[model samples]
Target: MKRTFRLSFYVICLLIGAFVVSWLIFMPNGQERGAWRAETGGVVLELTPLKATMFSETAHSCHTVIAFPAHMKLVEMLEGATVGMNGAQLELAIDGTLNTQRFDRLDALPENCTAPDPASASARDVFDAAWTAMDEHYAFFDLHGVDWAARRALAPAPDARMDDAQLEDMLLAMTAGLDDGHVHFGSDTRGYRSPAERPGWIPEGSNLNRDMLRQIAIANAGATITKSQTAPIFYGLREDGIGYIMLREMDVDVPIGGRSMDAMATAFANVLADLDAAKALIIDIRYNPGGSDTVSFGLAGHFIEAPLPVFTKTTRIGTTQTAPFTAILEPQGDAPDPRPVILMTSKLTGSAAEILTLAMREIPQVTTLGEPTSGGLSDVMGFTLPNGWGLGLSNQTYLTMNGDLFEKIGVPPDVPVPFETAPFLDGKDPVLNAAIAEASKYLQ
Candidate 1:
């Protein structure tokens, strides 16, 4: 009996040991646990493993391996880089894993690949390579309605006398070759601008500075018709107790609580409060170049009765893997009975503004007027390029509540108002006028 009892105890111990081994074998690794604050270059960033896979085809020497870090998606790592993680330097092999070799033995890539300019390679050559690669790889290239070959053929000549504006125009032409609405060229100082020139928007003798442009934009927003003074940003006539607000850009930072957000919230609230007694609202962002979307939502919430999904964006994991798009919503605010709303847009409005419009587009009481928007409906995270130029491109594609993609094709207007020159010249907006005419029916 003693022998049998001892044997049973040994058997139970063996079983427990096996279970422990199994658990360890199947447990998730540190990489699978999600985002962690990591130190890189004396700066700490929220780091997450994008995707790590093992490739074991050992037929050739120097096993081939690849690794894509989350930061790499935002900023490309230098070639031949020895990635450091968890206090360990990782070596890449052709075999698709990072743990194959010694620290500092592999190469590290500089900001722009650390590759010296090829022998006598001009900026034009670099531009060509980038332009061609973008044309080939950018998603939704065909929908842009641009002639890539023709534009490429018109490459800048040797010793091209390109001013900042001309250089920007050329870059714009090159980018248009990709034809993705979300792709654009932005200034290092200014965040974004109109890709193509707008009529009378540029001020005469206006130096490229904050004060000069701010004054011009403000005057455009509130210019009087009787005055011969040129105002490019805005000009409107109040009608039927409903004041039409047409805007071209919202790029300026509006301080809120001494922060940009505080300013934006105040601006949004003040705009609505100023027009409180109005029977209807026409928020015309037809040529709006887009701005902070959080502000768009705060303003949009004023008209919504319930929360609704506005748009979504996703991050790419690697060449093949992609993360799910994150969704944003329009929250309901304390507006009295939700005022009737109408929005005007063109192939120009985008980003945060697009998200706002999409959320309100389906409501029965709200109607979108004018032509389709720019179709650049994506969530962008801005970063400085290696050349000290700031860029904000689509990091994720946005989808509507009904699972519709609004990337290449813009949001269609319920009432399509074609562009007319005479009304614009006379400072009478056809889109706003139409909205007022339509709202008059509801108000009556």
Candidate 2:
């Protein structure tokens, strides 16, 4: 699985076998002097192309396909390279999937290429390389209230006598004060990560599968079964005149992933159309880990009745941040009139799922219940240590429209209720139970 650099602890990636027209650039664009450009339509992204063997036949083949097992439509079939010095410029919409790709050879700096021989560098050299990279690219020091300079000063340096293990410890110490989950340190084998919040992992031994949900909807809700658009997304009406749309995550079918936002909006429109007869609606995201922000926005747009500013974000460059980019939400495609809506959540809900919660909270008829979402925001941007080790950090910060920050602190539920997997083990759902009871108030 392959995903964008802007990932939470869990974000997946994959795109269609694009690059068929593989716009190859052997010479410089004469723009960046040493760099070249490969343009495509979609999200603006710079992809690193590792060294590829050139036999004079040109770039061809999906030699290695990386898949990100997340809940998103974002995917790319990356092939060919130039020692990671080459990069591609992808033009993806603010809410579009990346189905196609391009390739370009760029003569860039060493950090963009593979690391130097690990044996050639001292333990201290590797540590310093990591420290310097963060000094230049890491983004959330201010938000975490961390004095990175002071912290760096106090950090224990790797001594010549220290082994690789000790060096790893020293690197981990550099960001211990920062509660950003995006922070990461890794060698060829071992690794360490600082979680933004706790209790965010999925519950153990939980069997919340499509089969289970289908059984519950049929046996208890007395809903009609339609063997269409199965799994991932489920929609139907309950015996008590209530409707539900339980999405496993903000994902899409591969075919649909290559399309535009209108495609996703139309999918939701169809689901809502099926639930049109119900008196109230229940939207469950209790098990969703996360995916693309665009997919989340696409789903949320269906319920949004008016243009509303939900969240603002900015990239951290050096000590300052980039200009703020605020995301607006409004109705798209066919949407039902405002009705009593329940959003069931849990610690598992994070990344774009958190974005969805943030967006839904603004509506008057929507009430979020169950556990708070995972506080893991920001994309995990990656860097290469001098010894070829991997270093990841949060280089962006997302905030509410009112400028409220929830980093390391999740979005709280309007009605807090602990969800238990044991209930699912017994062929029941605690989250659904709570939603059903809450739906009582709106029942006419």
Candidate 3:
């Protein structure tokens, strides 16, 4: 009887041991824990086998990996990245994923997340990784009007038995048909711009700066200006009761842990207060490279008096798009009396700025002048290739209030003008003068 009882006890212990071993080796998820924190925002991340969740006091968001991989591969790729998460998190929030925080930096890594160097990753693995990521989550396969499957078939060296340059060229070829500037991939040392530029764009911004734009406004419009300390915003009053605001980018420069929208709001209020006496406003986003959508909407709100249907957003994930979410821009913060407001744009104005332009278009008093916007309206969804190459792709679509698709086709101006440096070279500003002229009619 004693021998039989001992045998039963040993058998039960063996079964328990086997179960734990399988869970650890085959599943490998039980070890994952909270490993990283954003440099700002008090946001923390919890990474599991195939999912990432970010949370803060007031917000929580979850993002799932579309194509599952062995646990360590994802960790290695992430560890290789020096920047991102802000882009990753924003990609979700941009397309209406709830409560995803924009984090510029992560403070740590998953403990014991050791893997072979990414250099040893085969080209086939990298290629397959990129292809699957896009196929599952890329939002513009229909908009770009190309068969993504074909891109995969056409990928050179289908075996991925090539060198880095060859792999990059193959990857670039895959995206050559996409009209999205936000779509690009690269390793830590090298990069490639989109082979296709927007219809009216310089892949690089127009190289205009706020200081130069401010100086020109002073020269041509007899303007008095002050640059914002908290952000890349500059504003003052121009002659003939016109207000001028030069937005270098839809971004602010607050320190780590500072709230960007709050900082922008304070700066915007100060600008509005100074230009309170003006009858109209000239807002130049001609030199702006887009940043936070929150800041963009926050600033745009100051120019309106009523809530309006602005834009609709949709995101692609795991082979399907989420249900469309439409948004309204409620009148927020300080506002001037309803009067003409000109949004000056160049091909340089994009992303969040383009979304801002779309919002402003709904208002009766707003007019967009100068060149068309960059037309890249989607947020840059972030990913990591098997080789640890960082990848960003347009994963969201922003439709107009009437459901117009405006991805590659930029936001058309109410008053379009040819983009040329000649006006600036000759000590004149035609776009500014034209905007002022347009605003004068409203004032009269």
Candidate 4:
């Protein structure tokens, strides 16, 4: 009986030992249980909110978005950080299935580094500042084939005897080499003009007004005039069963009578309803300076039967990094009946107007007529010099779906109608005339 009891005790001890061995093997170690490591290092360029974007020398990459662990309070540590600083590093420790991260080390920034103050900076300082601004933010140096370093060498250094006017001229000459129509440098006293030429038809002094243009279009088409002075829409059906709508500009509210988008859309719908029986439509955007892109989308929505991707824009976020986003036109209201649509364009037709043309071109039945566009589609970023001079530069690029760059190269017309001032002087619009003839072909 004693031997049997001892054997039972030994058996129970063996079972307990087996359970301990299994627990040791299966249970995670305290140090190894919930730990992961991810690390990237780069020169800090921009720090906003909980995001840090940097230019890393190893990969030659910029605008890398690094998310900080909430527990680390890294953003607070970056409060003193400044742009153009080098030797910035980040380390993150992620814990467990929750994947919560903690900062291993977020070093405080040194106080010695800061951007130069533009307020009291010298001429050379101002020039250098402007150059650096473009170097860091301008989106198209390589695309424009501009040797920015070479241009910097050509800039005259600030001398104690130099006047503001001379400094302005030097800065102007430096920017002129870029050949970008969007680049501008100016002070209250004077400004620099870009030599880039815009292609379009410009009527003589008195005939340049919209009233005269409307009259010419009306007389040429033999169409009764239905106009809203407030909405600034000129629309009617031609006697030959062709429809015409002339939009001078796209604005949410016009100064003439406080015209709103709803009013504009209503006006558009009314005109289309009147011309519903017409065989074709002619959209005249000649000399229309572009306004809100939202307005352009709203206008394009009426014509598109489905959601159409028009173009995409890429903005420079670092010296060599860019972020791209797309703009699409969603169908709004009922889609108009598919018909042959001719869009009239000129050098004066630019910005949102050009965007409208791009959206319209996506429609299978639409054709762009007249001269090439003004080629100013991208949004401009403005900068101010330390010397109180203001500068504007194109900091973004726009492209079509097939990846065509149209910054300086305007959108070409399918049917080219070379604009001549003589035709307008003689009470004739050859461009409009050409569109009418083109529409007639589709009707027959």
lDDT (Cα, tens digit) per residue for candidate 3, span 1-444: 999999999999999998666545533243333245433222345555444544321111122223233343332333211112333342122211212433433446434223324766677666666776677667777777888887767644534578778888878777777877788889668877664333333324663454565467557765766788777877777658889888877776644434555556677877787888888888988767688776776677776777777888876645566667776775667563465788898776777788789888888888889887777988776665656676787877788878888787788899998766657656678878888888787677
lDDT of 2: 0.60
* Candidate 4, lDDT over the whole model: 0.62
- Weakest ten-residue segment in model 1 by summed lDDT: 55-64
lDDT of 4 by residue, 1-444 (tens): 999999999999999998666555433233222212123122232333333433211121122223332212322233212122113323222210001112222333223223334455677766765776676666667766888878878556466435778777778767755656667777667887454333334533555555566567666765776875445567878878899888878754423322233445565666678788889999888767776566666566777777788887776655443445676777766665577889998776777788888778877889999977877776655555655566667766788877887776678889999877777777888888899999999887
Tens digits of per-residue lDDT for model 2 on 1-444?
Answer: 344455532333322213211323422123322322232110112232322211101011001112222111222222111122234432222233212223343454223233245676667666666666677667666767877777557444455645678877878777777766568888668988675433533254555553454465345444664422622666778878888777777765434234434555667767777888888888888667666666666677877667778887776655677677777876787543577889988776777678789888877889999887877767655655555577777666788877888766778889999866566567766677788889878986
On lDDT, the candidate that comes out on top is: 3
Global CA lDDT computed for model 3 = 0.66
What lDDT score is found at residue 244 in candidate 4? 87
Worst 10 residues of 4 by lDDT: 94-103
The TM-score values for the models, in the order shown, are: 0.56, 0.67, 0.71, 0.65
Number of the predicted model whose TM-score against the real structure is largest: 3
Residue 97 error, candidate 2, Å: 9.2
Q: Who is ahead in lDDT, 3 or 4?
A: 3
Candidate 3: residue pairs that collide: none
lDDT of 1 by residue, 1-444 (tens): 999999999999999998666545433344333222111110112223444322111111111122344333122222222233434433222111111222221122212222222344444643454454343333444455666556667677665554445656666656654434456554545433434223233244534223333333233433232211211223333545654565455433432213322344455555555566767776767666566555565556656566665555554222331444444444433452376777877665665567667766856678898777777665442332222333344434566667787666678888888765554444445555576787677687
Clashing pairs in 4: 118-386
lDDT of candidate 2 at residue 5, scale 0 to 100: 50
Candidate 1 residues lying further than 4 Å off, grouped into runs, are 1-137, 142-176, 185-239, 251-263, 316-321, 330-337, 380-392
Displacement of the residue 158 alpha carbon in candidate 4, Å = 3.3
